[model samples]
Each structure stands twice: as structure tokens, then as C-alpha cells.
Target: MKWQRFFLLGSVGLVSICILLSTVRNLVSINTNCPLSRVDKTTLQPTWPKNRVTSSNLSLNRDNKVHVIIFTRWKYGSTFTGEILNNNPDFTYFFEPIRREVYKNRKIHRGVFYQDLIPMLHNTLKCEFIDKNYTWWDEENKSLDCRYSKKLQNSILCEKSTIEKRDISAYLSKESRSRMVEEICRSVQHVAIKTVRVPDLKHLKSIVTDDSLNVKVIQLVRDPRGVYLSRKVTSDVCDMELSECDELKNNLNYWKDPPFWLKGRYMLLRYEDLADDPIEMVHIIYDFLGLPVPETVKSWLRINILKMSSSSKSAYSWRTKITYKTMVTVQRYCMDLLLMAGYKPVNSEKDLTNLKIPSIRKFSYPLMPNITFGVAKPNTV
Candidate 1:
């Protein structure tokens, strides 16, 4: 009887060990076999991949719902772009859900940081916002705070002003609000997120390549000179340096040769062009994403354009204030990116007078032509 008891105990222990080993294997596989290779510091190879999506164990889903990330740099009119999607009744937009995480944990090791960040993004995309607790970094106290909870609630669950007039709170308690958010998340056909927190293109691999999500990326870029002028006027510190510009140029070059499978997964849009022709640009973006232009988005754009016109603010208005010295400095630092992006340099304020924001009409695939924008055709080989 004692021998039988010992054998049963040993069997239980073996089963536990096997379970632990399987879990470890799954975790290891998630990181080790990812398509985006780790950053090789010695060779300066970027941790982000602009080439191809690596095939992995992630299972793809046949559901046709679309997911989009507006991958952009700081102060590049991302808010305006995000609002375009936000106004669409059919789309659910999340604004910078990972900003606090990225800012507070800047010193964390890159690989581990990405591992945590990628999953956080996946959860956000899945509308698992309320189930998890997140703390935003308070710059003044240098501590994590839940001050953004209300903002998250408004951005994700409900816009207070929109619902307040209807006395939503009389019936919708906190618990019910969460349930409402979950149902909205599940029923929405499209999910859109705008973020500047992502450090590299490689960080997007798991989400974009996952077969379960029909993810698309819109890389928003601006004239570096315009970016510099805007930052200078607002006293905003420039996060991008000359070295980063060089890296960006190299990344663009790499993207010029992306694998065939990645052809229609992403596209580039210029903030300047979008500003010049908001309606046309939005229409093109809708076409690229395989979405029709909803009436709500049209009304929002019309109202927005009128407001901007009445206020005397335009995308290139800052160019007049940029000093020649500042122009030279900006040109020197951003020359590679300017040339690669087909932006012409302005030597003087007078040069800004006749400068035209390039109009992009249709994008062609494979080579990603200098044309405005491109999306993959459904049945293309």
C-alpha cells in the first residue's frame, strides 16, 4: 500500500513538471522565433523589421474585421488624423493607450520592454482595457498615477459630453459602463489606434502579422523642416536627432524592398498633403483601408476644415516664421529624409511662397511608388 502511494505521488510530480516545461517552451518560442530580429548593438542592425513578416505559431482568423494603427512621430498632426477615424460611427478609436508605459519605462531593456509593450498593444486592440489596471507616469512626481483613468474611459468607453446631455449616468453605473464598453468593442467592425509610442517598425510584427487580426499601418510623415518649426514655436523638445534621421532613411530604403506578402499591409501619408486637401486625403485613406466614406466622417471634416480656415491656421503657415539659419540647420539635420521623402528644401522664407504640398493620388504596389498612397488589390499575385 505504501509503494502504491509513492508511485501515485511520483506520477503527479511528473505531470506538473511536464506542464511547466510546456509553458516555458511556449514563452520562449514567442520571442525567439519572431520575425523582427533583436537589435544587434555592435552592427547597429535595427530591432524593427521593414522587410517581411515572420511566420509564427499565431493562428489566423477568417473574420474580416479590420484593425489599423496610425504609426506617427511626435507633433506630426497625428491627433488630427486620429480624429478623422474617431468621428466614424462604425470605427472605435483608441488614442495613445501605451504612451504612459513607453514614457515611464524608457530605461527598461529594449527586448523586455518590447515584449511587454507588444502584449499591451494586443490587449488594447482586443478592447481588454477595463479588465487590466494601467498607471500613467506623472512627470512632476516621477511616479505612476491613475489620473488617466477618466480619459481612458472617455476615449474608449464613452465621450462624456456626447452622452451627458442624455442623462446616461442615471441608468449606467460604473459596472454597467464596463459591460457596455465590452459589447461595443466586440460589435465594432473596425478598430483604429493612433500612437507615437512605438519605437520601431519591428515592434509591430506580432500584431500586424497575426492572422487573427486584419491589421494595417498608416505611417504619417511630415516635412522635417515643418516638424522642426512647429516644435520650435511650441517650445517642444525635438525627440528625433540627426542620427535618427539617418536611421529613418535607412529604414525607408529597406522598406523599398519589402517581401511580397507585406505589400498591401502598410502605406505612407504626408501630413502636409492631408492638410492641403483634407477631404480627398481622407477619401484615399478610406479607399486604402477598404472602408467606405461614412457620412459622419464627412460632416466632421467639413466642420473641422471650416474651423481651421476661420482660425487662420494651416499646415505650412509656420514656414514663414522659420529663420534662414534655422532652415539651414534643419536642412542639414534632415537632408536624407527630405530627399528620400521627395520634399524640396526651402533656402529662404520667399521660397515658401510658391511651395506646393505634393498631391498624392493613387499608390502602386511592389515598389511603393512615389505616388500618393497604395493598397494591395484583393486577388493580386
Candidate 2:
């Protein structure tokens, strides 16, 4: 009976040892692979592909996911318009992703700008940032600032201490941050990019032509007079030799002869129109994007744009605030483009200052040769 008891005790100890070993192995496995398990394996490319699959083509079909590009220039109310989509939970928005490169570097040449900037835009939109050319220097780390990108602020990475955080210094390696952002980009229902760097719509032909990317381009334009006034009062973001009128003319000419591919994919939204009726404009914007207007956006408009203080409204009332001399200068340079864009040039100081004398031609559509404003066709809007 003593020998039987000894054998049973020895067997129990052996079973206990096996269980401990199995637990140790499982813990090691979890520690080694848990973080990676969260990452989508398909996007774990050794290097970015020559042509990457856009976010729209990933888990969902192209029809279900849309990529909206807010293409505009400086002082054009791109920031305000971008917030419309940025506030939406469905969109993973990138605010002026190319600003540091374009504005800080001041590289706007057709050849060099297209070669350098377009690829960056494409890689970012497609959620691929692993290329050797995509390195960010110390100064360029401003792109990681949550102040610029509210979506980044909403991420788990952003801490409560500061609005700005450097990915290279504070959080993770560049590649790791890229992987995280790419993961976030892929998981979202839509991707939206607001850029003031794109001077000409024709430059985006490559991105727009990608059938896999359900691309909708909203070209936001403020009256060049308002743009000039804002630029004068505020410090200039960048010193560009090209005037606002020149850029406006360039875009208008491009709109006139937009390639067949651009027909249904493009939209021209006036800043005045949006400022006049934000909710209605948002609905039109949603209609253009083929999306149902989310209640969150309506709530945002109410809190932000609608309930804005009189003092704040006065700040944006450039039409009233700008002096007669300033108005004449802008109107002189931008007159043809202004008339084309449905803005009236004031003849005198009274007309410029008077709220009754309409500066913006209300209900007038932009002079687009092929398409109507706020209408979305099969390919472009």
C-alpha cells in the first residue's frame, strides 16, 4: 500500500510539470506574436509595391469605400471645408499632408513638383509609406502633429500632454508609425485628403485614373479678393510668385478642358456658397460623394459653424472687412476669373462695404464646360 501511494504521487508531479511547460510555451507565443496578430499580414510588404492596392480595394469592394480629395489652394477655406469630412467617424482624414513639402520647400515647378509630390500623395492615399524616398527629416516631423490631423489626435498614440508629438522621437520609429497609420488607414470605411498644394487638377490624373480608388475631388475656391485679404492680414503661409488669380485661372482652364476621365469625378465648391449654408452645402457634398449625411456632421455644423460667435463671424467676413483699395487690387488682377467663378467685382468703396450689394452671385453655377455643379455622374462629380 505504501508503494502504490508513492507511484500515484510521482505521476501527479509529472503531470504538473507538463502543464507548467505548456503554459510557459503559450505565454512565450503570445508575447512574441500578439502585436503582429493585430496587423493585417497582406499589407506587411517588404517594400512598397510598384503599384499598390488602394485602401478601397482592400477588405471591401471598390463600391463600398470612397476616397475624397479636397483639392484647393491657400486661403481658400480648405481648412473649414476639410473639417466637414474630418469630423465624420467614417473618414480617416489627412489634413494638408503635402504642406511641409510644398509650402516649406516652395517647390511648385510642373516637372519637379509632379515628380516629387504626386507619388507622396499616391503612397499616402494607398496607405503605403515604406519606400526609401519617403524619409522625414526633423523639420518634416510636423506632419505627425495631431493639431494638423484630427484623425491622428483620435488615435491611441496621441497622449494628453501635447497637441504635437514627434513620431521619430517620442512614440515609435518611422517605419513603426507608418505601419500603425497604414493599419488605421486600411481599417477605415473611407480616406479623405485635404490639400492646398495641388495648383492644377490635371496633375491628379494618375490618382483619378485608378479604377480601384473611388476618387471624388472637391476643388474649394474662395473669391480671390477674400483670399488676398486673408493673406494680407494674416502672415503669409508661403511666398509664391504666382498670384491667387494665376492659380485660379490655371484651374479654370483645366476645368474647361478636363480630360474624359475627369468628367464625373470632379466638383467645384465655392467658399461663399459653403459659408452661406453649411448644412445644405454638406448635404450637397454628401450627395456628391454618394454618402448619406451622417448626423455627427450635422451636429458638428450646428456647434461649430452655426453657433459661431459674432466676433468670429466678423473675422471671416472678408467681403465686408477688406478696404476699397485692397478690393480693387484683387478685382483688377482676378476680374476675369472672378466673373467666371460667379463673383461680382465692386466698382466703389460703398459697393464693397455694403452688405446689401451682393458680391457673390447667389445661385449662379461655376462655368464648367462639361458638368454641372453638385451633380455626380458615373466617374466624376
Each prediction's TM-score against the native?
0.65, 0.72
Candidate 2 error regions (>4 Å): 1-61, 107-110, 135-140, 160-169, 233-242, 305-316, 364-381
Query: Model 1: which residue pairs collide?
Result: 48-202, 360-372, 363-373
Please, what are the lDDT tens digits per residue for candidate 2 over residues 1-381?
Answer: 999999999999999999999999999766654321111225421111112233422332356687889988877778778888888888888877776676557745656776678877877777776543554322245446577556677675454435654343355666666666777777778898988877677788899888768787888877777677677654332233236677777786656567677665677888777766565566667655767667677667656643333323543477677777666766776777877676777888866667777776665332232343433212211
* Residue-level error in angstroms, candidate 2, position 148: 3.8
lDDT of 1 by residue, 1-381 (tens): 999999999999999999999999999877665543432436532233222222210112135467888887788888888877877776777777777777778899977887887777786677665655544222232232122222333433333336454333334445555555556666667788877866567678778777777887787877777777667643322335575566567646535655444456667777766765565567567655766667777667655655544322446665666676666766778777877665666755566554454312233322232222343321211
- Alpha-carbon RMSD, each predicted model: 19.9, 17.8
Q: Which stretches of candidate 1 lie over 4 Å from their true place?
A: 1-63, 130-181, 233-239, 308-313, 348-381
> How high is the CA lDDT of each candidate model?
0.61, 0.66
Q: Residue 137 error for model 1, in Å?
A: 12
Question: Among all windows of ten consecutive residues in candidate 2, which has the lowest summed lDDT?
Answer: 44-53
* Model 2 score (lDDT): 0.66
Residue 19 deviation, candidate 2, in Å? Answer: 74
